[model samples]
Target: MSMNTFPIIRVVTKLLIPYILLFALYVQFHGDYGPGGGFQAGVILAAALTLYGLVFGLEAAKRVAPPKLMQRLMALGVLIYAGTGVATMLMGGNFLDYNHLTHDVWPQVLPSGQHLGIFLVELGVGVTVTAVMTMIFYTFAGRQHIT
Candidate 1:
């Protein structure tokens, strides 16, 4: 069965994307004080990107974010979060311990750097999740048969 690509879908997709991104950012940053961290943000971002893929088609989505690049980016995001923990451990502290970030800077610098690190990790998670979701949608959305 074929389905119509309606104008409403385009309208909704365009209007909702920015809000989705904003909400994801809020969830990512506010997680330290409460809940809803990288995972939730990633999901939201992925959902938004998937909608874009659905409305726009696989080629457009791939143009926006290629599949191979998405795979590497997702792995990089995981590695970054893991790397920070490993670096802390190598410094003889517990995993994710901020104090290991720097020596000369002391208490303030370490916390600041840690906060920045967390933000970068969150951003990476968001980007990778979005790209991967788009790629998955593209793969599953069906292909035309060649004559």
Candidate 2:
């Protein structure tokens, strides 16, 4: 059966996608304080997109987030994660030393900087994972043929 054949599924999926994305963001940002984290958030986000693809068709999913964009996202996420470390080093601290993330601006805010650094790093990981997972799903889905 096609997605269009199921009005209820289409309507429900459309209504739920926003909430899924919102939850993913919450997991990504509130990870330090709660049980969720980058990996979990990334997977959640990818799952939402995968659901979209399943319901809307792979071509539609590709139109929403093209493969090229996914590749770029993967690369960009890694760059952000690595760049954070490089930035710490440039600030005259050891690698991955989040304490130095804001030493110059506000020495008193060292802890805050650490939180910010961790958030950025986690965000990078989440983005990379989301992209990779979605890409994988797309690859497999594209290969399938109805008998």
Candidate 3:
């Protein structure tokens, strides 16, 4: 039986996708304080995209997150992660030093330096991982397997 013929699956997928994305965000933001972190959140985010592709179609998934955009995101994520380390160095501290993340001129609304640094690094990791996993799904889906 073709899954495409089932309206129920599509309906459920549509209902669940948003919640999945929300949970991913929750895990991402709370990661440094708890068990969940970049890797788990990234996988969760990617799963949402994959579920949409499975219910709808590979082309649809690509439309939602184009390969070009994913590629650019991957690079941007890495840059963010590495740039954090470099920023600490430039601030006259050892690489990846959260203590140096704070500056005298920095706004007070944000969290402490350690928390802020962890947030940025985790954000980068989550982005890269989500892009990579989603791209992998797209790659496999697009290919015609020899049977």
On TM-score, the candidate that comes out on top is 3
Q: Which regions in candidate 2 have their CA more than 4 angstroms from the true location?
A: 103-111, 144-147
TM-score-sorted candidate list, best first: 3, 2, 1
- In the range 1-147, model 3's lDDT, one tens digit per residue, is 125889999889889999999999999999987789888999999999999999898888899999999988888889999999999999899999989888454677777788889999999999999999998988888888788
Model 3 lDDT, full chain set: 0.90
lDDT of 1 by residue, 66-143 (tens): 778878877777777777778778877798785566645566544565665576566656656655665566667656
Better of 2 and 3 by TM-score: 3
Q: Which segments of model 1 are wrong by more than 4 Å?
A: 1-5, 102-132, 142-147
Residue pairs with colliding backbones in model 3 are none
Worst-scoring 10-residue span by lDDT in model 2: 103-112
> In order, what is each prediction's RMSD in angstroms?
3.9, 2.4, 1.7
Total backbone collisions, model 1:
0
TM-score for each predicted model, relative to the true structure: 0.72, 0.90, 0.93
| lDDT-best of 1 and 3 | 3
